[model samples]
Target: MGNLTNAVTIVTSASSGIGAATAKRLAASGARIVLAARNEDKLKGLVSDITEAGGTATHRVTDVTDPDDLKALVGLAEETYGPVDILVNNAGLMLFSKWEDTAVGDWDRMIDTNLRGYLHAIAAVLPSMLERKSGRILNMSSVAGIHVGDGAGVYGATKFFIRGITESLRQEVGVGSGIQVSMVSPGVIDTGWADKVSDAEGRKAANELNKGAIPPEDIADAVAYALDQPTSITVNDVVIHPTN
Candidate 1:
């Protein structure tokens, strides 16, 4: 836990939900957090809230789908605080529709945001992290990545890609580089993500799932745990599921 003190971190999709909660939790533990999201106003508000609470924070409006935007985000963290010691790739989109009914545009958006976006962030930061020989990358996946559900075929595929990519990257980085790559798979979280479901039945089902859903803060605690571990101890995967 003390290892987190004064550590620099970047959390994407940080305007709300799990990303926001994780940013606050890390700040509370003495990490200087950089919040990245598409919403500038929300990012600023979060930064203000953390600062008012006596925790250090900064932010940049970022669209993770854009490689250049990701590069600028890393630059902001470096210039404002220092080199980022941790990167939490938490930004994602969930568009649920049956395989036969899914629109091409929606499918493209899901792949671009959920899969390619993670790749873009990794590419933007890996050079510096590898050069420095130290860093932690925490990718937010989901239980859906493991178990398929109705109307979530494409969304689940995207998350599955995240899991696969993170695992392979972990092996590639290995134990010697001082780089830790971990994946967090949360199940039935209480977030407004259900609003994005196109099918009314899917939306209702998601709402029902939320009846026993874990809070975003629970996942935040998991992220903090991974970040706080000793440099040599890499937690490759963490799954947080609510007990119904």
Candidate 2:
């Protein structure tokens, strides 16, 4: 149970939900946090909370869908706290709609924010990690990635892509490189993501299923567990679901 003291950790979508909770927990464990999300005000609030608790923090307003923004995110981490020791690719969208309904905009947004954004974040930090041979990348997938059902087709595809890349990256990095890659799959966590469901039927279904959903901190705990582990131990493919 090693602490993350002085670790330069970047968390995307850190304004709320799992990202925000994870930032708080990591900051409590003594990690210097770099928060990135679309919400600058929320990011500032988080920075204030962390700093008030005696934890160091910085923030950037980033859109994960943009390569430039992600590059700047990693750049800020480097300039502020040296090379990024860890990256939590947490920014994502879950615009659930029926496949046959032809929600092209929703699908495109998902591809950009969920799939392509994940790639961009990795590409931004990987070179330095490769050069240093020491870093961690933890991508947040969803249980739907492994088990797809109604209203989850496109979203599931994105999570599956994340899982695939996480595995591929871990192996590509090889052993003795000191780089760790992990994936987390959380089921039905309580967050504003549910409201993003545009389809009437899909939104109703999601709302019904999300009843009694687990708190975001539960997923955050899983992230903290992975990051706190030794470099030799990569906590990969964590699946967390509510018992109720």
TM-score of each candidate structure, all chains considered together: 0.96, 0.97
lDDT of each: 0.89, 0.89
The best candidate by TM-score is: 2
lDDT tens digits, residues 1-244, model 1?
Answer: 4988998999999999999999999999999999999899999999999999999998888999999999999999999988888999999888666667656777898899999899999998888899999999999999989997777788889999999999889888846777999889998787788788666666776666668878999999999998899887988888887877
Q: Taking the tens digit of each residue's C-alpha lDDT, what string does model 2 give over 119-175?
A: 999999999999999999999999988998688899889888988888889888846
Show where candidate 1 strays beyond 4 Å.
none
TM-score of 2: 0.97
